[model samples]
Target: MRIEPAFLFDLDGTLVDSVYQHVLAWKTALDAESIELSVWRIHRKIGMSGGLFTNQLLRETEVEIDPERIERLRRAHAEAYQRYASGIRPLPGARKLLAWFTEAAIPWAIATGGRMETAAVNLAALDVELTKIPVITRDHVRYAKPDPDLFLAAAERLDAPIEGAVVIGDSI
Candidate 1:
């Protein structure tokens, strides 16, 4: 028997217009550590996990390594990102696309690197019904995007098989 297809959508920049917000948030986090780096540099590493993002940024900037600062930086980014929560809104066609899926009875879930607090804001802004489906956040998985763990977890939560599942997002 052929299994039904399902979709996994990324939260930031996919369903919601938060790419630039993420860039600014990361910059703010780095700045909180008194680490001065170009926003352009941080922008390139947008979708990485908090830990990986900090490590990669430090490596690329050739800055002194400080393992203790990763948590501080993450907390700073979380705080900085929360400021933009009220400004967040669904992207054009996001509602339509999700509605189409709903109407067609297709199962879809959110797979994101964003934390639950921020994800909750975006979902509320989009009016997405998490009760009906599942969301796989960075907290749910060890690795971030480009890693299949999030995808796998989302599928499992939605009871969708991996073979025919698809991920829809703004980034690669």
Candidate 2:
């Protein structure tokens, strides 16, 4: 019997229309640090880990951020995100796609740069249960995409082969 392919999805842009919310969250976080940045810049680095994202943002803009300050900013962002959680929702065809995978017994999972808790909150907001799907977040992977570590890690966790898996992401 031929093995079925695994559908690997990215959380922010691919499965849901939460990019704007994320931008807002980051903006809110940075604002607490008195740093202002463009949503486009934040959007472009959506798939990197929070620390890396912050570091990259600082580096690209030649801004300096204290370590403790960055942590505080992250916390502030989380709070802001929780406040607007209800507005987050899955994109068109996302639910249909997941259902299709379920009905077909095709293995599917999310490989996202988001923290486990944050991912959980967003998935819950979207009415998705992670227990039904394989998920590999920043906590589970040593490296994040566009390095393929998260995707490869998801495939491993699902007992699925990498060559038989296809990654569906909006951007690198």
Residue 50 lDDT, candidate 2, scale 0-100 = 82
Off by over 4 Å in 2: 1-3
Badly placed stretches (over 4 Å) of model 1 are none
lDDT for 97 (candidate 1)? 88
lDDT of 1 at 34: 85
lDDT of 2 at 122: 63
Q: What lDDT tens digits, residue by residue, belong to model 1 across residues 27-109?
A: 88888888899989988888776777888889877878786777788888888988967678889989898989889989999
TM-score of every model versus the real structure = 0.93, 0.89
Residue 37, model 1: Cα distance from true site in angstroms:
0.8
lDDT score, candidate 2: 0.81
Local distance difference test values of all predictions, in order: 0.84, 0.81
Model 1 pairs whose backbones collide: none
Best candidate, TM-score: 1
Worst 10 residues of 1 by lDDT: 63-72
* Error of model 2, residue 86, in angstroms: 1.7
